[model samples]
Target chain A: MRATNDTVSSRIEIARAELTPIQFATGLLFAAAIAFVLVFLQEPLAHDAMHNFRHAAGITCH
Target chain B: MIVDYLQRGILAGVVAGLAYGMYMAFVANPLSEYLHDTQHEHGHDEHGHDDHGHGHGHGEHVHEHAEHAVSETTTALVSIGSGALWAIFLGGLFALALYVLEPALPGPDGIKTYVLAGAGFISVSVTPWLVLPPAAPGAEQLYSIESRLAIYVALIALGAVVSAASIAAYRRTATRHPAIGVAAGAVPIAAMLAVVPSITPTVVTHPELSSALVSAYRALAVLSQAAIWVLLAGTFNWLQRRADPATAVDGSHETLTTKQ
Candidate 1:
């Protein structure tokens, strides 16, 4: 029983250590995805909107 | 796991993007302009129309303009695509380095590994931008938007890969070594500096500025890139630390347990 408990505890610890880095890595991956969406989609949307607004406003003085 | 990856990826990506974007805006863009001007001046001299120079100036200007357009188009394709491609490659390299280095250091839970990965990614991503003149001459302003975006994407991808790989590798090693991580991260910067001359044009002449200005600008470009990478690395380190089990115990533990 003691051996089993030790095995279980060690397994848990191992699992914990393994998952910690994975968790952080996952965070980074997710962050990258968000950045992609922002750069590819969100920024373009904002840019188009701003362009249209400026056109309508006749702000082409430049 | 998916959500966590997405979150961290996006965070690191945005931070990397901003850092890269600023470098592009202030340094790379200016350097490209200088290169373009010099190229045009040389072109004019090559034609040897000293007597009719004024008359041909306008024609030369138009030709320069066309050249600028072509350069811009090509640069857009190369800079964006190549930048992203290199970022992914560099990320893998950083991870591999960390994996090899992790066993030799002393620490707890691979904090060092994570730090090293972050630093390595930042250094590699920023170094090329600093050293390599804009891929295309003359159209810095035109291609800046597209090229910068591509580079940013690449930097973000690189950071994500490096961070993920290093962390994964470090976890497997029995002895936790943070120094290995730090050293791994620092190695790439040294490597980049060593190779800068080979990859980048040396002693470029500029029509707009004296030799001193060119040198000063080049130096500034390097400093700006280094500063940007340092900021990026610091941000990633802070994020990792915040997410580390030892630091933010309650919230991170809860998150970890729920995931388990």
Candidate 2:
């Protein structure tokens, strides 16, 4: 039982320890896109659609 | 792995967003409408005979009522639809942040999840709130929307900087002086507060709305946002554990036992 526990713990540690560079870059790009849509995009209809949420979330919106 | 993380985030966000929409419809919308109505009443009083007086005829009044009904339905639908979409976006961001920062953040996965959630709240909501607090519909505005948004974007970037600096500080100084690490982390925020004259420039429109009501609205907004972060973190952590057979919580798995 102890050996089994050790194996499981080690496996979990290995899994948790690493994040590849490609993964990091992908996350960064995805996050930036979401930020742009929420904060920067100014098309009239899209702006109006998200207006209430922008306000509710405390983002600066008219 | 990235796809799995993104999927979990979307699922969590949908759950939180539905709750957020309900909050906007039932709690926030009514409060804003009340404040808006009061503002118009004040306007009517000041003018002594305004557009509201023009709508007093019986036919016009019924037509106005119908218009208001339609508008209310539209508002509720918009709140739900947009709430879901925005929450999903935020959830994806939150997952990505966790993915990138997990290696640097100390502690076990569970603790790190909550710490990330707190950081998310600070970066996304609390930090910008220092300068641009959540305001009621009738607040006196000093800046245009463009200026406000520019400032907001800058403040959010600053928030991310502060979060990273604080984490780096703690990591570097933790063995020697932990308290000093905390103070160092706080230095940027303290300096900003000192330099900025009107940190919280929110002002309720006078003679129409009370400061207390505005405060309540801001408080509710913060609470709802906090709820989203909490939900995101909890859901993501649960999903991670479920996906990993080695860490499975269920007792049915013979190889992965909870008992020591």
Candidate 3:
């Protein structure tokens, strides 16, 4: 049987509520991975690599 | 599995950060260098620009350029790495904020990207700067460190709070009357501007550096931030389009009945 517009809309609503956390989690994972780049590749990047976030935030720690 | 939109957003952010960081490292002129060079020139001039190149041998100018600044190779390496990290931070920031505001965002990805990018710039950079203007390393602090930190944090906090409140209000009210939603947004914006006098600009006491140089440096700093947001919005949007980021239920029945 073909799904009505009402049926489809309700389904999307339920799916979205379920997916928000998942989407956010995926984004967070990606962010963590990016941070790992600096941590794992410490030998090549030098000191400035770690403080890049501070600079982006306009903080002058030094 | 439909493409992981959030993961792609993170990847996009990392790429944007690297792009900005590299721009900052190799391409973007370092404000500190300008300050250092100007200070050097001023000191040398005061003593007298001696005809002989050996004049710097004495005690007056002790800062050997080679000793203080890192080597070119080192600087570039550090710069690229840092750029990547910065991009990632920015990317993650937008991704989260956009996710929260996704319901309010319009469709078609094209128009939506502009709104997302513009909002990202405003919330992340503009609102904060209204209270805590961006500063270069050489700039003098007009206030105490604690005070500066407080204002910076407050401004950023205020920015986030206001945007979230305003968007939620707008969306909620728009159902009955779209104009009411537009009007509702103004309240949070007004609250954001409630205290402006408290924020004083940083002083640049370095006598040698010209105002133009200082202005240009700060502009570059702002530009660097703008670039990151642009990159994030452009790249992330492209990826999200490819992934077909799930649309949120905006609470508008008209919109609801029209699409799926």
Best-fitting candidate, scored by lDDT: 2
Predicted complexes: DockQ each: 0.05, 0.19, 0.15
Over B1-260, each residue of candidate 2 has an lDDT whose tens digit, in order, gives 43566688888888788777787777766665666566666554332222232232332211111113235446556656777676777888787666555656644567677777877787888877877787655444456567777888887887777777767766677667767766765676566556543645542233346778767778888998999888888887777777675654422124323322
lDDT tens per residue, model 3, B1-260: 11244565678888786777667665543544445455656455433323122243544222212213345456545656666766786676666555554445644345455567766676667676675565543333445445665666676676776776876677677788878877886677766666553454532233345677656666776787888777888887677555443432222233334443
Worst 10 residues of 3 chain B by lDDT: B60-69
Give the top-scoring candidate (TM-score): 2
Which sequence of candidate numbers ranks them by lDDT, best first?
Answer: 2, 3, 1
Best by DockQ: 2
Task: Please report the interface RMSD of model 3 to 1 decimal.
Answer: 7.1
For model 1, the superposed segments whose C-alpha errors exceed 4 Å read A1-62, B2-6, B38-67, B70-218, B241-246, B249-259
lDDT of candidates 1 onward, in order? 0.41, 0.63, 0.55
Q: Compared with the true structure, what per-residue lDDT tens digits does model 3 show for residues A1-62? A: 22223343454463465567878688579768867864574342344333333333455322
Work out the TM-score per prediction: 0.39, 0.71, 0.62
lDDT of 1 at A29: 100
lDDT of 1 by residue, B152-238 (tens): 456445544554454455444433565655455444445544665465443222343456655655465445444534443455455
Which residue runs does candidate 2 get wrong by more than 4 Å? A1-52, B44-70, B176-207, B248-260
